[model samples]
Target: MYSGLMSTPERLIESTRELLWERGYVGTSPKAIQQHAGAGQGSMYHHFTGKPDLALAAIRRTAEQMRATAEAVLGGTGPAYARIEAYVLRERDVLKGCPVGRLTMDPDVIADDELRAPVTETLDWLRERLAAIVEEGCAQGEFTPGLDPQQVASTVVATVQGGYVLARSAGSPAAFDTAVRGLLALLAAARTPASAPAAS
Candidate 1:
C-alpha cells in the first residue's frame, strides 16, 4: 500500500524518521535509509544532497509534529491544571520514549549543529509553553502565589525525560507512571486551597 502513491521524497523522509528514532544519527547510514525507504541510492541522492540533508528535513518535521501534538492538549479548553495534567498524562510509548527527547543522548546528533538545533529548539519551546501554562494557572489562583512558572515547567519536563530513563532501565512502564503520579501529586499540593464556601 505504501508504494501505491508515496512520492520518492516523501518515502525518504518518512523512512528517515522511523530509522532515526530506532537508531541515532551514527547508526543510520545512507544504505540503511535506502533499504528502509525502498528507494534506490540514486533516488535518495537525487532528492537530497546526502544523509545529513535528508535527516535535517526529517528532524525538522518531527519537531513541528511534537509541538503541534503538545499544543493540541496544552491549548485546549480546560482549567490550567487540567490542561497540564492532560499534557503529561496523555498516553505515550513508554518503552520507545520520546522521539525528540531520545535524540539528546545521540553523540553524533549532539556533535552536529544541524542535527541538534531542532532538538534544542523543540525542547526549549516545550519548556516555554509549559511555563506559560503554569503562569496562567497562577494568575487564575489555581497555584500558590509564590510558585515559579519556569522552575515548575522545567521540573515537569525533567520528570518526563527522567521517567523515560527509569522505564528503560527497569524494563517496564511502572517507573514512568510512578514518576508522573508523583509529579501530579506535587502539583496538586502546590495548589492554593479554595476559599471556604460563603457562610449563611
Candidate 2:
C-alpha cells in the first residue's frame, strides 16, 4: 500500500502547523520544520522564501479549519444554547488551548498583520456567528428579552480564550472547566423569567 506522496510545500505547511502548536512561532525553526516534514532544505526553499512565508500559509490553513468548525457547530439543528453548549463541550485538548488562541500569544505571529490577519478574522467571525445565534434565540423567546447578544458572544469567546491562558498558567485544566461551567450557568440564568428570584 502506498501512502500517497505529499508535495514538499504541503508537508512543510503541515509540519509548521504542528510545530507552531507545540512550540509556538519563535520556538519553531525552519530547520526543525524541514526535519519534521522529511523535506530537504532546498525543497523547502523552493516553495517558500522563508519562515514567514511558510507561516502565513500555515496560519491561513489553520484559520480555515477553525471557521469550518464554528460553522459546523453554530449553523446546525437544535436551539442556540444547546448548539453553543455542544460547541464548547465537544471533545478538545483544552490544555493545549485553541489553535487560534495559541497564536495570539506568539509575539512574532501577532506582530505581523499578514500572519495575524487570519487569526483575527477567524475569532471575529466566530464571535459574530455566535452573536447572531444568540440574537435569534432572544427573538424566538428562548432567551431573555434583555439579553445582549453581542455581550454574551464576547463573554463566551473570552471565557474560552481566558480559560486557556489560565489553564496553561496553572498547569491544569480546572480553570477551563470552571470557565465553561460559569458561562453555561450564566446562560441558564438568562433563560429564566425576569420575575423569577435568583436561586439562593
- The 10-residue segment of model 1 with minimum total lDDT is 191-200
Clashing pairs in 2: none
Ten-residue region with minimum lDDT total, candidate 2: 190-199
Clash pairs, model 1 backbone: none
Query: How many angstroms is residue 92 displaced in model 1 relative to the true structure, after the best TM-score fit?
Result: 0.8
For candidate 2, lDDT tens digit of each residue in 157-196?
A: 9988898888888989888888888898889778746433
**Tens digit per residue, CA lDDT, model 1, 1-200:** 25758998988998899899998887889999999888999999999999999999999988999999999999986777888889889989998989999999999889899899999999999999999999998898888899999999999999999999999999999999999899988998888777222348
Off by over 4 Å in 1: 1-3, 195-200
Task: List per-candidate RMSD values in Å.
Answer: 2.8, 3.3
Q: Model 1 shows how many backbone clashes?
A: 0
Steric clashes per prediction: 0, 0
**How does residue 133 of candidate 2 score in lDDT?**
89
Give lDDT: candidate 1, residue 75.
93
